[model samples]
Target: MAETDAAPSIALPPRQTDGWQMLAAIERVLEAERDQLALWVPVGFGAGIAGWFALPGPTGWIGLGIAAAGVGLAALLFGGTSRLGRAVTIFALAMLLGLVAIWTKADWVAAPRIDRPKVVALTGIVEAAEPRPATATIRLLIAPDTGNGLPPRVRINVDAEDLPAPPPAGSRVAVRARLLPPAPPMVPGGYDFARVAWFERIGATGRALDPPVIVAPDGGSSLADIRTRLTAHIEASIKDAGEGGIAASFVTGDQGGIPEDDNEALRRAGLAHLLSVSGLHVTAVVGAVMLLTIRLLALSRRLALHAPLPLIAAGAGALAGIGYTLLTGSEVPTVRSCIAALLVLGGIALGREAITLRLVAAGALIVLVFWPEALAGPSFQLSFAAIAALVAFHEHPKVAAFAARRDEGIVLGGARILLMLLASGVVIEAALSPIALFHFHKAGLYGAAANIVAIPLTTFVVMPAEAIALALDLVGLGAPIWWLVGKALGLLLWIAHVVADAPGSVANLPSMPRGAFALMATGGLWIVLWRTRLRRWGVVPLAMGAIWSLLTPPPDILVTGDGRHVAVRDGRDGIAILRDRAGDYVRDVLGEASGVEGEAPALELMPFARCSADLCAVDVSGGGRTIRLLATRSRDFVDIRAMTRACAAADIVVSDRRLPRTCHPRWLKADAPFLRSTGGLAIRIGSGEVESVAEQVGLHPWGSFAAGSR
Candidate 1:
C-alpha cells in the first residue's frame, strides 16, 4: 500500500522543479504585497528621473518617442487583464509622468550661465546677505543696466575689511568683481554644484575686487531682513560665538557664523543635521504651536465644546510650519519637512493613520513633482530615507505590538521608549550609510550613539529655551533665558566634540561606484517597503553592494583639469601632492577622494617623491606593481630632448603645458589639451583604467558652464 501511494504521488506531477518553485514563491510574495503597490509608484517615477539625468547627450524628441511607444505597448498588453500586465501599465504611466515633469522643470529653469571669468562692474539691489567672520556673501538682483549678457542674479563675496557693515537686503550697491560660472564637480562622480546653482538661478559667483558702495539704502521689512535681525540679536545675546551661532542656526537656519572647528566637530559626530532646519526642528515648532493653541482654546469651556479643538490646533500647527519654512529660507530639507508635516496634519484632521508610509510617499511625490532636481541631492535623499526607515521599522507587526503594550510603571515605560529610540537610531543610520558614503565618501559610525543624547537635548531643552529667549528679547527681559540657552548649547557642543573625538567615530570609505550605490538603494527600499518575510531576500543585493564598495580600490593618480595640481597615493594610509602651494580645498578634496582619513598628509613630503623647480616625479605602488608618474610643477621651460626622454621613460605624464608629440608615455598623457577635454582624471595604474569628470558628466547643459579653466 505504501509503494502504491508513493507511485501515485510521483505520478501526480513529478514534483515541481527548482525554477517552478521559485516562481511560485515569488507569486506568493506578490500576493502578500498586493496592497503595497502605491508605494512603488514613486519609486518608478524617481527611476525615470534618474534615467533622464543619466543620458550621455540630450535626447530631445527621441526620449519622448520612446515613452509614447512604451505607453502604447503597455495599453495593448494591459488589455489581456493579467496582473503582470496591469503592473506594467501602471509603472509605464508613472515613469512617463516623471519624465515629463522633470523635463518641463529643467526647461523652465534653463537660464544662461557664464562660461568664462570676466571682471565686470555690477550694480544691483541686494536680494540677500549672509555675513561671516572674514567675508560677507550677497546675492544681487542684477540691474538691467549691466547688459543682456549678464545673468539676472549673481552672488559675490566681499572681504569683511572692505565693508564697514554688510549691506542690508533691498539696498542697491555697485561693485567691481571678477565673476565666473558656478563650479562643476571637482572629480568624476563628485557633487555637481553647477546643477544646483543652475536651479537656484545663480549664473555667476565671484569675489569683490572693489568694496561695494551703497548707491541707495532702503528702509523696508522683508524675510531676509528679519532673519538677519534675528541672527544678530541671538549672537549679541549669547556672546559666545560658537554657542550663539548654533542657537542662531537653530532659530533662523543661518549657520554661516559657526566656527569652522565647531562645524567640523558636529559633522564628525553625526550631529550636523542639527544645524540644518529639518523635520526635528519643524516638528518641535509645529507641536509647540498646536499645544499652545489647544491649551488656550480649552481654557474656554464653552468654545472648546463646539470648536473641534484638535482640528483648530492642527490648522494652527500647519500655519506655523508654513511660516517657519518660509522664514528658514525654504531650503530643501525644511521644505520637505513642512510638506510632510502638513500632510500628517491633514491625515489627523481626517482621522486616518497619520504617520504611515503613504504619508511619506505623498510628501515625496509632491516634492519631486515640483522640484525634480532635488531628486539628485543629499538633502532630499537623506530626509526621505530617514522618515521612511522610521515608519517602516515601527510599522512592523512585532514592533507595533511591543510599543503598544502597557508598561507596569513609569520607569518601565521610559526604558521601553529609550530602547525603541536606540533601535530606531540604529536602523536609520544603517539605512542612510550608503547614501552618505556615496555623497561624502564617509559615514559617521558613532552617529546613532551620539544622536541618542543629542536628539533629546536639541528637541526638548535647546530649541524651547532658544525660542522663549528670542521671544523675550523684544521686551528686554531675555538675559537670563539667553544665558540658559547658551548653557544648553554649550552642553550640546561638548557632546558633539566628545563623540567626534571618539575613536572610530567616522567610517572613512572609498568612493562607491554608481552601480553599487543603486543596488544598495534598491535593496534598502525592498526591505523597508515590503511586509512579507520574503523581504529578507533583499539582503542578497545589500551584501553584494557593500562587498563591492569595500573591494573597489582608490585611484593611484589624481590630476586636476588645469594640470596645475596632481596627487598620488603615498602609502596605505597617506596621499602625496605635487606642489607644496596647493590650496587647502584642493588638498582636502584629493585626500578625501583617495580614501585618506583624518588630517591630510603634508603636500610634497612623501619619501618616494622628488621635486625640482619645474618638475615632480612620484612613485606609487599598488596591486604588486609600481607606477612612475611625472608632472610639471611650473611653467619653466625645459629642454625638449630632456623632457621627451623623461616622459618616454615614465608610465604617466601630466603637464599644464602641452607635451611634445615625441613625449609619449607608456600609459597616459594628460597635457593641457587632453586635460581641457577631460576636465579631471583619476587613473588606476594596476588596472590601466582612467575616468574623467567630463566623460562622467556627459553633455548636460550644466556641464557647459565654465567655473574656471575646467
Candidate 2:
C-alpha cells in the first residue's frame, strides 16, 4: 500500500474557557495582524489628505505632519523584531495624536470676501464655470497668490476680463480681482460656496483686470492657448451631442452639458458614472485594446513572437488612457484611477497572469507622493475607497464570482451587466456612504440601480461614440457621429430625469454628528482593510446604528412661518437650519429615524431630537403633515386644521395683529407672536399657547389680523 501523508499536525492551543480563548485570539491578532493593518492605514489616510496639502497654508503642514507621523508609526511597528508590543502601543498613540491634528486643521475654515476697492492683477486657471453665464472666474493654483502662505502661491479667483466671448482654454491673462465670499443665501438649495471653495483651496474671488491676454513662452509656444482651444472644442462637441452623451464628456470633464434633469434621470437609473471618466472608463478602453490585440495576434504567431504584440497593445492603450486623462484636465480621481490601471497593465506586460494588492499599493504610494493634498477632496477619498473595496472584494471567493471571470466576456445580457454594475455601485456607495452623508447630507439611494442600467450603455454605446467622434472630427466627417451621439445622449438624459423625479429619489439626509460620523467612517475602514473577510467585527457599524437610533431625541420646538415649519434644536448642539418651508426638507434635516411608519414619530425620547413647544401656524397638530399653505394674508389662524387632522388642537394659532379674538383659543389670547427685526422676525415659543409666547416678549403685530378668525 502506498504510504499516505497524514495531515500536518494542527498547531492548537490547549482547550480553555471561552473568555480566556477569546482573549488569546484577540491577543494573537494584536501580535500578528494589528501592526500590518495599522501600516496600511496611513496610506489610506494619506491619500485622503493629498489634495488638501496641495492647497497651501496650514493645511499642507498638517498633511505633512500626518504623513511624517504615519511613517514613523509604521517604522516603529514594522522595524524591530523584538519590540513588537512596544511598536504597537507607540503606533496607536501616534495615530491618536495625528488624527487630532488632522481633524483640528481641517476645521480651520476661511472666510473669503472680495475687496473691489483694492483690486489687484492676478493669474490662475478656470476651475469651473459659475452658475451664471455673465462671466467666469479663474482660481489661481499658486500658494503665495492665495489666502495663506508667502511663497508666491494662492488660489485667488479673477473674474474674466470683459471680452466679446469667452477666451479659449489655456490662455494666460492678468486680471484685477476683489476677492469676496459668496453672498449669503447664495443658491436656492445647494452647497455652501465658502466651504466648498475652501476645500478647492480658493481664497478670494474677483474680476479680470483686462481682456484675457495670451501669454507666450520664451520661443513662442502658448501651450495654454492650444489647451484652451482644445477644451472649448471638446466642450462644444459634447454640447452638440445633446444631453447625457458621455463621448465628449470622456474627453473633457464637462458633463454639465448633459442637463441636470436628464442627469438626475440617469442617476436614478444607476448609470450616472458614465458621465465621468474614471476607473471603469480606463478599464473599458484597456479591455477593447486587449481584445483587439489578442484577435489580431492570433492570425500570426510570428507577430506575437517577433513584434511582442501584447506589450505594444498594452503600452498603446495605457498611453491612450494617460492622454485621455490629460485631455480632461487630469482630475484627481481620473489621475489616480489611471495610475492604478497602468500599474495593472504594467503587471500584465510583465507576463504575470495575476495582479496583486502590491500593485494597488504601489499605485497609491505613487499618487500620494505626487499630490499629497488631494486627500481633502471627496473625489480622491471615494475613488481610492472604491478601488480598495473592489480589490478586497475581488480577492474574496463570493465576490470573485461576481467579478469578470475572463477579460473576453464579463457578462452579456443588458440586465446581467446592469446587475453587475449595480453590485459595484452598491459596494462603492456603501463604502463611501458615511462620509458622503456626513459632508453632503445627500444620499443617492438608487445609485446602484442607476449604475446597473447606465454603465453598460455607457461602456458599449456612449464611450465608443466619443472615440469615434474624435476620429471623425480629425477626418473632417464628425458631424454625423456627433449627431448620433447627441441623440443617444438625449435618451440617456431623459432616462436620468425620469429617475430623479421618481417617487423616492434624492434622499436629503440630515447632517451627521461628528462623533457618529467618525464611528461610521472607522467601521467602514475596518471593513475595507479587513482582508476580504466578513469578520464578526463588521457588525460594529450596525451596533452604532442601533445606538444612534436609541439615543436620537425628538425636536424641541416646531415653528411655522411664511408657509414653513422647522424643528428647533433642544440639546447641546449647533443648529444647521434649512432654507425654507418644505416640511419634507425640514424632516430630512431631523434625520430618517424621525420618519417611521411612513411618517415622523411623535416621540419625546432623547434630549437632542426633542422639540420645545407646539408653535407657529405651519403645523403643531397632526405632525405638520402637508407642506402647503397660502401666504399669510394676516398672521391670524391660517386654517390648516383640515390638513393636520389633529382634531385635538390646531398646528398653531397665528395672529398678525396685536388684538385678541373670542374665537381664538383662550390660551392663544391676542398674543403678539411675530416681531420684525434686523435679523428677521423672532418666532418665540414656550408659552401655554402657540402665539402666547410672543405676547409675553412684548412683540406686538402692527396690524388687526391677530384674530384666529381673521
Candidate 3:
C-alpha cells in the first residue's frame, strides 16, 4: 500500500479550474431545482404585466416593443443550448408575452370613454339590480343603447320614492340621468375606484333624476336573473335581514344585500372571506361533491367495479366547481378556483398526481393571461398568497409527517384535523397580514382564531347545505333545506359578532410604502420557492420590511378630493378632521391611515389648529421646519377676507374660492377645476412636500376618462 501511494504521487492536473468547477456546480444546481425555477416563470411574467400597467402613458408600449425584440434575439442566439442563456431567454420571452397579452386584451375590451358630464337618455337591458337599505339608493346596471357612442355599460343610482318591487335582471329599462365619469382616488395612495370601474366596463356613473321605467318586461332567464331569483328565495326563507343577507351572499354571491353593520362585523372579525365566493368555498363545494359521489358510487357494485373511482370523483368535482362559479356570477376569485379545480381534475383523469404549487401557478397564469388587470387586484394577490403559503408549509417534511399520521379512532382523528386546521390558519394569517395592512390599512388580530371556528362551519355545514338547497330548489323541494341553511348561517353570524367585539381584534396600521411590500413579498416567495439552506436569508429582508413599516411616519395632512374636508395629524398622533359635513370614504381612509379611531373633537383639542365658522388654520412643526395650512369653503365675504389674511400668513392655502392675485403663488386651490384634475391631496409637513393621486399614479387607461376631462 505504501509503494502504491508513492507511485501515484504524480501531478494531478490542478483540480480542474475554479471557473469550470463553478460552472459545473451551477449546472448541477439548475438540474436539481429545475421545477422550482419553472414556478417563477409566471411570477416574472405577472410582474411584467403589472409593470406595463404602472408605466406612464405610451412608455409601456415602447418598453414592450424593446422587450419583444430582445426576446427574439435572445431566443435565436441561445435556443436552450446554455442553461444560463436559456434562463435569460425565458425571462425575456415571458416579459414580452406578458406585454403582448395585456396590450391585446386592453385594446379588445376598450369601451367608449366619457368626455364630459351631461344628462343623457339611457335605454338598455337591466343586467343587475342591487337594492340598498335605503330604497332610494338602488343600484341599476343599464347596458347602453347601441350606437349612442356611450360606454357599453353604465351604473346608475335609481331614486324611487315608492316602487312595488325592485327591477329584476333581464328587464329592459329606460332612464334619464346626468352621467359623469367615475371618480378617482380620494387621496394620494388611496383606493382607485375609477380604475375598478374601468375594468368593469362601467364608463360612467350617475344618479337617475327619476324612477327608471321598465320599457319591456323580463324576456328570458339569464345567469343574472337566476342569481337574483336565488337570492330572493334565500332571503325569503331566512326571515331575519342580517342572517338572510349573509345566507344569500354565501349562496348567490349577492353581498350588496347584506346590512352595513353585518358587513363591517364580518370584516372586523376576519370572516369576510366567507361572504365572498373564493377558493375556499369552491374547494369545499368540489370536495363535498367528490366525497359524496364516491361514496354513492361505492354503494353501486356494478359501477364501482367497472369505473375508475378517482377519475369519476374528479369529474364530479369539476362539475360542482363549474356550477358554483356560474352561480356565484363568475367573479375573479371564482374563475381562479374553477381553473385550479379543472387543472386538478385533468391531472387525475390523466393518472398523475396534482402538485399544489404547479396547480396554483397554472391557475394564476391562466387568469392573468386572460385578464391582465386582475394582476393588480387584492383578491388575486391574497388568494395566491394564501395558497402559496399553504402549499409551502404543507410540503415541508415536518408538516407532511404530521399530516400523514393516521388515527383510526374518530375522536383522535378529529383532534388531529383540528390541529392541522389551526396550523394552516396561522400560516395563512401570517402570509396575508402585510398584504391586508397595505391594501386595507388594517388586519384582524384574531384572524387565526376566527378562521378556525368559521372555516369548518362555512365549509362543512353551511356551503354543503347551500349547494343541496340550490339543487333541491331545481325540483321545487328546497324550502326545508334553505331553512336549515339559514339556521347554520345564524350561528356563523353570531360567531362573527362575538369575535369582532373582542378587544384589540383589529390592528390599524399606517399604509406601508409599495416598496416595502415588494420586499416582503420577495422574501416570502424566496423562502417558499427555494429548497436549499440559503432560503434562511429570506428572513433578513422580511425583518427589514417590518422595521421599515414600524419606522415609517403617517401623512401630516389629508385633503379630500371634493375639497370640503381635511384631516390634520394632532400632537397625540390622532386625526383632527376639519369639515362641516361628514367625510365618507375620505374620513375612513384617513382614520385608518393615522391609526386614530375617531375624529378629534375640536380645534382646541388639536395640536396645531384653530378654527371658526369662516376658516380653519393649522400649523405643523417638525424637523426644524414649520408648515402652515389654511383651508375654507365659505363663500361669505367676511370668511373670504379671513381666509385671505390666513393665506398671507400660511405656507399652503386651500380653498374652493378664488385666491387673491398676491396669494396665488402660495395657494393650493381646491376649486372644482383643481379637484377634478388632482383627485385628492396628501401633504408632508416636515419636508413641505405635497402629492396628488393623479400625479403619483399618472394617467393610464383606468384613469383616462378623468384625465380626458382635465
Name the top lDDT candidate: 1
lDDT string, candidate 3, 63-172, tens digits: 67596668757665955576755766776677778877776776677777686798988888878876663233678888877866689899988754633456777788
Clashes of each: 0, 61, 0
Inter-residue clash pairs, candidate 3: none
lDDT at position 82, candidate 2 = 32
Where model 1 places Cα greater than 4 Å from the true spot, the runs are: 1-28, 59-72, 75-80, 134-148, 216-219, 705-710
TM-score of each: 0.93, 0.62, 0.90
lDDT, candidate 1, equals 0.81
When 1 and 3 are scored with TM-score, the better candidate is: 1
Give lDDT per model, in order.
0.81, 0.49, 0.76
The window of 10 residues in a row where model 2 has the poorest summed lDDT is 696-705
Q: Per-residue error at 118 for model 1, in Å?
A: 1.7
- lDDT per residue as tens, model 1, 1-710: 44553444435657899976875676566777887778888887787777667665566335753874577476656443544456566767777777777777878888777888999888777888777741244334444245536887788888777875556677887789899888877766567788888787888888889878885465667897788778878888888899999998988998978988898889888888889999999999999999999999999989788889999999999999999999988998999999999999998999988899988888888889889888989888998999999999999999998888783799999899889888988998999889888888878888888899899999999898888887887798889999998898899899889988988888877667888888898899889888888679889898889989999889878888678888787776777778777777787778778877645554457778777788877887876789889898888898899999999888899998898989988888889888777887888877877888886666666776233223
List ranges where model 2 is wrong by over 4 Å.
1-23, 27-39, 43-165, 168-178, 181-201, 207-227, 234-246, 256-258, 263-272, 289-301, 353-358, 401-422, 531-534, 545-710
TM-score of 1: 0.93
